[model samples]
Target: MNSQFNFRFSALLILLVATLVTACKKGDNVVPSPDLGAQVAGTYTYSELKTGGKTYPASDTNLKGTIKLTRQTATTVAIQLAIVHKATNETFADDAAEDVEVVESGIGNIELHYNGDTIAKIKGTKISIEGEDDAGTLFTLFATK
Candidate 1:
């Protein structure tokens, strides 16, 4: 009778421990990504510009610029680019604020979409953007806040 009782008690204890272990299993603690539009909404000055395999630094008198980013929504931002060409004293600028969508947000970077195409990325205080002009000249702008 004693041996039988001991066996029954051991079995019950083992069952209780197993149940507790299962009940205390780790849960899925999913954390959502940050809102990149709001996080990166600020003015940034051009650090460099690349086009047609030619690189222009910000110190280049003819191709210096700034970009303004305004948060319009949790996932959208209004961007205006203003670049000045000193030789001609011509200012190339967006006549109106263009709406850009923040399509993807990750741990260290955020991707931006313009006109249904991915054209920009923001990491830390820097933004890199690629675009083409009406003449089909491809360009990339690197800016920092």
Candidate 2:
């Protein structure tokens, strides 16, 4: 009779513990992540440009540029580029902002995509973009806010 009572008591205690564990809510204390688009929205000046195994600083007389990023929506960012080619004394400016989808790539990294292609990556206050011109000159731009 004593062994039967002990077994029943142990079973009751196990059931109580199981119920308490399952009743507790998860993620109640978890902090939500910030919006990637909003976090990266700002004006960034080009710090460096790389092409043909050569790097040009922002102060380089040949090339300079600035990029403006605006948060268009929760998952979208608009980008506008203003660039100057000193050799040709020409300026390239976007008449309209291009929309790009911002997606979280990792814990602290975000990627910008346009037309199903990744055009840029943002980490902290820095952004790196890769593109080619009409003449097929592949270049990478590193900018910082």
Give model 1's TM-score versus the native structure.
Answer: 0.67
Highest TM-score against the true fold, candidate: 2
lDDT of model 2 at position 16: 97
Question: Candidate 2, which segments miss by more than 4 Å at Cα?
Answer: 1-24, 27-33, 86-89, 93-98
lDDT against the true structure, per candidate, is 0.79, 0.81
* Error in Å for residue 74 of model 1: 2.3
Q: How many clashing residue pairs, candidate 1?
A: 0
Candidate 2's TM-score reads 0.73
Give lDDT tens digits, candidate 1, residues 59-128.
8636677888899888889888786675774775443356788865567778878788776788888888
Point out the worst 10-residue segment of candidate 2 by lDDT.
Answer: 89-98
Candidate 1 whole-model C-alpha lDDT, 0 to 1: 0.79
